[model samples]
Target: MRVLLTGGAGYIGSHTAVNLISDGNKVLLYDNLSNSDASVINGIAAITGVKPTLIKGDVLDEIGLVNAIEKFKPDAVIHFAGLKSVKESSLKPLEYYSTNVGGIVTLLRAMLKTGVNNVVFSSSATVYDSRQKMPVDENGIVGNAANPYGETKIICEKILADIWRRYSLNVTILRYFNPIGAHPSAMIGENPVYPNNLAPYITEVALGKREYLGVFGNDYPTVDGTGVRDYIHVCDLAEGHSLALKNMDGLKVYNLGTGKGSSVLEVLRAFCNVEERDIPYRIMPRREGDVAELVACCDKAKKELGFAPVYNLTDMARSCLAYARKNFSGKIK
Candidate 1:
């Protein structure tokens, strides 16, 4: 299949590009490099032995998007372009809505013009209400997202559903859980411009870049009093995208994550075990919009798309630390 990935140079998009090319698919990358580095294209080529066709453009640029689609003539698209920081979203909700929500509007308009109907959207587990049942399923209620970042995801999902009903567009929404870890080759990993998530922050602490890890809220109703989440390997999440593209027909949704939950303290311990260094941390007040536990019930994805996680917490810790070491030592660009 010939596919075009928006934001293809970013963390998850770069890993997904490698997976797609490894599976014998031609890929064209469209990105503006706002939150990602252009050097990542070289890493993708080093791993996959094939350089993807890249168009340096933003998702909100309708004319550029239409031209790229017309030129590449992709059979499908995996949309991943947007601002993705929950804390940042709370600060700049308008920017999040303008980019995350408006970008999709422009992309779909371009797709309609170019007759590209198939799309695999990158959704998030944050769309689920915090008070919903544990291990959220596809049938769970949406629209009660905790933060503006999650609210954008909920809005995007609704827009896609409406577009599917009106235009018969083929859409597959993959709601991802907490994605950690790096590629086994240490070629590409989660290197955000500004670290916000737990894994990246933990890695910063391990590398001595940060003084200490902040354990947000040890009073939560969890096993260790810290927040718990389903941490899935980035490779596994990338593979699920490929499978969704292969089996997608009309509008469908699936949660991509491990069925089990891991507490923040447990994750810190796993990293310490792998790196052989103790990470100092202090418990702080819980941030707003955080839930006690947010895990996925992935039985729907397992039965429908044949998706299952192959890596555990230990594997995640090892790969993440390895990637940080390589990146810090200038082994990987």
Candidate 2:
């Protein structure tokens, strides 16, 4: 299969590219490199022993997207391009909406023009309502997004569903939980310019680049009074994308997670144990749009797509530290 991945140089996209290439598939990466490094293409090539083609483009660029699709003639497209920071979304709502929401719109138009009907989207568990119970499923309440980032996902999902209904496009939306951990090779990992997620922040502190990890809101109704999330390994999440590509029938939504929740303090302890160093932390007040707990009920994905996450918190901690020690010594750029 020839697959086209938007934002293919980013963390999750690069991991998925390696998985696709290793599975005997061709991949063409389409990215603008706004928040990602071009060197990730080299890392993917080293891991897979195949250099996937990288098309320097943006998802919102209609002409560019159409040209890439026409040239590559992909069997399917895995859309991953977007602004993904929940906290930053609150500060830059326009940028989040224009890039996240508008990018999907432009991509759909280009796909329609190019007669491409298959797509696997990289959605988020944040689309689920915060008031819902633990372990959210595909049927869980949606549209009560806490931030603009989540709202864009909700909008994109709706648009994809409508497209499937109208044009019979094969759409697979994978709602990912908190994705942590680098590849076992430590070649390609999550390296953001401004660390937004908890795992990256923890890795930064472990590398002595940051003074202390900031425990956002140690007052949530949880085990350690901090936010709890289902942290899935990036490799496992990438495998889910491969599985989704195989099961793209009409329209499907799957939550990609480990089906387990871990508290902030618990994750910190896991990292400290793995690194064999005391990582200091400061508990700060809860920020807006933050949720207490967000877990996934992944029984649907397991039964349907054979999606099984095999990494534990310890593996996540160890791999993240390994990637940090290797990459944090110098600037990622």
Candidate 3:
């Protein structure tokens, strides 16, 4: 199958590109290089021995998207391009809406023009309201997102649903948990530019870029008294996309995660064990909108898409450390 991946040069998209190409599929990467680098294409080639065709463009550009869709004529599109920062989105809500929501509008318009109906959207677990029960599933209520970033994701999911209902479009929505780790090759990984996620911040501390890791709220109701989250390896997340593409028809939703939770201290200890070095840290107040636990009930994905995470926490930590040590020079970019 021929696939076009928006944000294909980004962390998860790049990994997905390799997985798709390795499975005997043709992939064309379209990215704006906003939060990703073009050199990731080379890294993907290095890992998969096949370089995906790349078109430098944004999802908001209807003309560019139409041209690319008509030219590549992809069998499906895995949409992964958007601004994705919870705190930043609160400060810049308009920018988040304009880019994320507006981008989808333009992309859908172009896809309609080109008659490309299959779409796999990159949604988030953030769409699940904090007040919902633990182990969020596809059937969880999706309003009251904690931040604007999550709001945009909910809005996008609604937009996809509406399109599916009105146009009979094929849409698959994959709600991802905390994705960590890198490609085992150590060639490409999460971006260091303004690192916002826990894994990247832990990597920075491991590489001596940061003085200490902040343990947020050590009093939460969990095994270790810290917040618990489902951390899925990026490679596994990539594979889920491939499976979604195969089974995507009408509107379907799945949670891509390990179905297990790890606490903040547990994650820190895992990274330390992988690096074989002590990482300094101090307990800090829990940030706003943080829940005591957020794991996944991945039964739907497992039963329907045959999706299961292959990498454990140690694997996630080791691969992340390898990527950081190789790509970073103790500089916090």
Q: Please give, for residues 89-199, the per-residue lDDT of candidate 3 as tens digits.
A: 888899999999998899999999999989999999999886777888888888888888999999999999999999999999999999999999998899745677899
Question: Model 3, which residues run further than 4 Å from truth?
Answer: 330-333
**How much lDDT does each candidate structure score?**
0.92, 0.93, 0.90
lDDT of 2 by residue, 262-333 (tens): 999999999999989799999888887788999999999999999999999999999998988888788432
lDDT of each residue in 188-218, candidate 1, tens digit only: 9988887778998898888888889998899
For residue 100, give model 2's deviation from the true position in Å: 0.8
Worst 10 residues of 1 by lDDT: 324-333
Worst 10 residues of 2 by lDDT: 324-333
TM-score of every candidate relative to the true structure: 0.97, 0.98, 0.96
Order of candidate numbers by TM-score, starting with the best: 2, 1, 3
User: For every candidate structure, what is the RMSD over all alpha carbons to the true structure, in angstroms?
Assistant: 1.7, 1.4, 1.6
Stretches of candidate 1 exceeding 4 Å from the true structure: 330-333
Candidate 2: give the clashing pairs: none
